[model samples]
Target: MDALYVPQGRSRRFVEQATNLHHFRLGIFLEVIDLHLQELDNRFNERNMELLTFMACLSPKGNFSSFDKENILKLASFYPEEFSSVDVMTLELQLDVFMDNMLSDERFCGLQDLNSLSMMLVKTKRHENFPLVYFLIKLMLILLVATTSVERVFSAMTCVKIKLRNSMGDQFMNDCLVTFIEKEVFLQVPDEKIIDHFQNMKTHRMNL
Candidate 1:
């Protein structure tokens, strides 16, 4: 395979090392992907999945109302952060009252997903009526959403803060990342105004 000339100072294995780069790269890549998938497999245990499914009962769809009250109560009792001792004790009572009240309210009856149900509760001025139950719903949503959200942010940062921008400081990089990630927020800002403000901060011997 001696097809090309090698530099006089280089090792004979230069061609071999070039070939090994792809092998090493693929090995590390697959290893990372496998670890991530394996972690997800371990994290999503049956009980956790069942509890999350039970939490979906708050939604109006999927025969949500037919969910077992005792199982729901047990799940509520387990999450002390969302439901304290006193709160947990009366959670079932609250749940029963919430279901009764919700079914009667036309606004709540029309709600479908957990998100819509959570938001509609506030719009209907009923979030306060079932505070603990509402908190549980919100907590479940935050748990489900916030986990993926943080992961997405880090993933984006890896793309954004590349080798070219590696010298950028942490605080400045964070600002850039925030601007990059929040596309809607960034869109509303006028670029000219930003340039003018920055330009005004320090005098430059150039036309504005």
Candidate 2:
């Protein structure tokens, strides 16, 4: 709290708010990673089914009934208690109903297809020996997205708290910060010309 560059009262409040936001974001990130792991496992476990189904789906003359049957059997084996004959019928019916609803609703029609999603999930699995490669690529993507977001927020904050306009009310400051963070963007530019270019661009675009 003392190191946050705020008064004691504000520091306490800011720290609490920051902690809650941190926890919320952390929870989301953890859940995403966990889901990724589950997807990788599913990909590895169902590689055969995935390959077969994908090939069938892509072929003009190929039939998917056999692949579908095999997938059901595999699922039943993996979750015997949850997926029996009755459960399979129920699942298929539910899937049909869901697809029907999606087709009828404009909001849902643009959503990703489940079959494509299933194929993608299966294709993302890597060998056990090359775990680092996949993780490194994922880490790089995450870092790129995160750094871009942070940079955008910092840029907006700088505009909000300019040298001559530093005397902001507390409520105004909070609102500005929130707006900056929520509407953050990532722009690519060389570091050497960044300062000059940013000022010129802002002036030209009237974004400042």
Against the true structure, whose lDDT is highest?
A: 1
Runs of candidate 1 exceeding 4 Å displacement: 1-51, 74-79, 104-107
Stretch of 10 with least lDDT, candidate 1: 15-24
What tens digits encode model 2's per-residue C-alpha lDDT throughout 1-208?
A: 2232333455455454344445555656788998999877854566545533443422212222222433433343444564566755655454444334334544432324334323332354421323322232243345447757776777777788887768888789778777666653423435557667767764575533
Residue 49's lDDT within candidate 2 is 55
Q: For each candidate, what TM-score against the reference?
A: 0.65, 0.26
Query: Model 1 — TM-score against the truth?
Result: 0.65
Tens digits of lDDT, candidate 1, 1-208: 2234343587877644334445455656778998998888777878778777677666666435655677677778768776777887777788888878877877776556879888888998788888878888887788788868887788789988999998999898888888878888878989898889889999889847
In order of listing, the candidates' clash counts read 0, 0
Runs in model 2 deviating more than 4 A are 1-124, 127-129, 163-165, 169-174, 181-208
**Clashes, model 2:** 0
Cα RMSD, each candidate: 8.0, 19.6
